[model samples]
Target: MTMQIRFEMPSDEALLLKDMAERFVADHYSLAQRSRMLAAPATELPAHWPRMADLGWLGAALPEACGGLGLSPQQVLPLIEVLGAGLVLEPVTPATLQCATVIARLLPEDRASDVLAPILAGQQIEVLVAGPDGMEPAVSARPVPGGWELSGTVRLVPGGAAAAAFWVAVDIDGAAVLRVPAAEAEVTAYRLLDGQAAASVCFDGVLCPPDACWTGARAALDAGAEMALFGALAETSGLVAALLRATLDHVKLREQFGRPIGRFQTVQHRLADMYICREEVRSMVQLAAEAMAGEASDKRRRLLSAAKVKTGDCARAVVRDAIQFHGGMGMTDELAVGHMVKRLLVLGQAGGTRAGHLTAFSAAS
Candidate 1:
């Protein structure tokens, strides 16, 4: 019999992680906490970082040799799911997993140890570039006395403002992925809606030794895209879950015409539909994660695109219904629904907009 993919409960270990994460969010981070953290100086997330490290979450996916638990992708999925439910913010979602996967798959063997070690150890913060929308390179890299000088623009780098370094792709003369130092490169930063920091980097006469150059730019980009898709799926899953819970809560006590609004057939049907959509989106995300873990490249790509399209549609629909169900209060920032909708909308378009993905899917087929 073929093994079925279970989208619901995870293993004991995953459950333990989930419980710990949920408790942490309850104790240390509510929506108020999120707002406070965002307003704080340095926007430093120190409290969260150490707690995550202590929980061994920082090293969840890396190999044992690199100070990680070496868990399979299946194991990591639950942890991310729990994070989604809690609406937690940490670099592990996109920055660590995506960057670490790129290093493991694309970087030279000699470089893997160097790159993954610090990340697993939680000593280094590496940011990945999403695209080149608003960035401009200052210096061009060319053969030098003993190394190379990199000059150019890398824009919309996630976590770039605080990154120790960046996994940058350069259109070297025409192409290459260059591992460059954030300290050496000048970067301008902007805040994302979800309170994450991103920046545009300008490289001005930055010196990169021969050791800094890595082959497999195209492969890394492809892998990065997949990683990003999964991250987005994970985040969307969180938003939908939050919406469901809030809507359920509102329905329970919200009275209309001498009965709870939830008692009405219409209200129940809307909620049931929302629940089904959320569950379906969850299944698609899980399938995409499985395909990625198996290294089924073509299958992974197709599944990721499919998940994005479906999830995007579902998110838009679910949030719209949620707002209508909750009435005007749902649209206010004080409530979680509005913020969740904003995030879902941004993420839906982040990796590749729905229209863009559809076009790509058509072209590929």
Candidate 2:
């Protein structure tokens, strides 16, 4: 008996958005531009953030009532994949998707419109500061006269330096979330190895009104983490795919033994292995996205962790092989592969490490 392997096709809208993202990246986002942005002073988002808002990409996963497209997470994966391939340095996952989801889902109805409107309009940037592995809250909150006072430090917040506001996870009796204006905290910003900016924010007696605090923050944080993981997986899949393409192109042009290196059986096998890894990661990403859209919370958490582990392992493998195939040029700044390898390394550590996710998956089981 013969078995067939099937791949799910994206929806028509997703296909359209994917094409738009590709064209946008090809026209506006390039390796040279990425390099320039990385070298620039860290502030909030790129100037193209407004353009992304104009294209409706910022609100792709938000509800229509909140000025978003009301699309599911699966529909937004294609755009994320394209952004990843371009190595765009925007904080789509940690800021737009994750923070937006938390605000939309957990914030009070009256406050949602106030927060989500500006964000969806690209007038504000917000970064989520949740603890890793769902452990203890990184920040703590105490009740004050009119509201809550937050005190603690949140480390390694993606895009935190440039954010206009922060969604901080705090323990006030239990897990709670607070929206603290960036001006209220001390932000120590630095760039990651991949040229992305992050920060350590210290909230020293920052006062937030009662309306700024949201209850049931644990569930919201879990959901936000899952969403962020899905976005990261999509981006990593794109990065792996781009690496494979670059490696193939390099092998085809670079001569070894008076012929293209790609003609060698050993080189061909290595390229094939890289391709297989990319495909596996891509499939797992899609599965996780689908689960996030439909599955129950417990099931979604398990699937997201499973996807993160698989994606991280495959990403490391693919990046390592791609670098090896590129010879000495792979590690140089002149080539994009070296930069991609750096991004993959960061992604592996983001959200949760592979070993950590595997442990989470096991515990869940």
Candidate 3:
């Protein structure tokens, strides 16, 4: 059965993107392909960078002059969800679009075009900057002579070691986008629990020159948080789908007593509950994306926090139920469901834990 979620009715551009993503998944996300990539030393990204760039997806949130699709959030969420469904590991979503937006706004008009062009083209990788742990975008940087020196580490920096550059945050000093040179910065990279690349970026006085240092730390922080939340939600959605699909398949195939488990009333009820949880979380994510695309600053902040809380709740419960429904296999790595559970557990706290988001929402109100 086709699931009906609020985001099903996305903008025309978003619909076009959905079509592209559908084709990409059908062609590239076969079980064999995913298994092969998983067996590789690192999670696979494929050539999604250049190919997605050609589709104008890598730059969907940037300006036309900057080599972007210049698309809005309403036009981008569907694409992101498609990426999530496939569990693709490309660094394009937050690394490029989210980070590029801040750089475009903070950097000189002339320079933004140059800096953002490579990002859109998938030639350069940028990291989302944030700081002050327990808060959104937790990390801090400082300005030094000739350039800004990024201090404190952005733990679990996505593609941190692999990324060619970064946009880091530093306390009330505001946010500054630093073009961190790989050769110059010391990076410790590893695969995250979900098979995504993560690293601890240490800057022993890494210089972010004036031209290279972009401002507007607060605004950037907000945007980055929203991007991150969306990523978490998308990932959670994929996991939820996997859990529900597996449950449905199990009920139809497995037998209890003399009949199929699917005929069991209790089993049917459990599956229905699972579907409800998934749909509710999906709706929250769509509303969050739409709210982010809105113009009101206060409203946007409030909506994001609400979305985070709702997503966290539904995701946590869905995975737990999936575990219970699957019995012992749910906790084993031999089963892909376990990985989804772990990822959702992490997502619940990534952007901000439920309590943290609640407090932030309260304070904002």
Best by TM-score: 2
Q: TM-scores across all candidates?
A: 0.88, 0.94, 0.87
Error of 3 at 352 (Å): 0.8
Residue 111, candidate 2: C-alpha displacement in angstroms: 3.0
| Order of candidate numbers by lDDT, starting with the best | 2, 1, 3
| lDDT minimum window of 10 residues, candidate 1 | 130-139
lDDT of 3 by residue, 1-365 (tens): 22222454777877888899879978886656766665664423335667877888777877676667777666677777777667666765557655677676566667878877776776757676554221243545555678666656666776564677766665535544556666667777777777666677777667667766555556655666566666667666666776788777767877769888779898788788889988887777777767766637676767778877877777777777778767776777666577667666656656656787789789998
Ten residues in a row with the worst lDDT in model 3?
131-140
What is every candidate's alpha-carbon RMSD to the true fold?
Answer: 3.3, 3.2, 4.3
Candidate 2, residue 63: the lDDT equals: 78
Task: Write one digit per residue (lDDT tens) for candidate 1, span 34-144.
Answer: 777767543243347656777888767666665667766666777776676565656775566677766666765656877876666666677665452111222356878
Native-structure RMSD, model 3: 4.3
**What overall lDDT, based on C-alpha atoms, would model 1 receive against the true structure?**
0.71
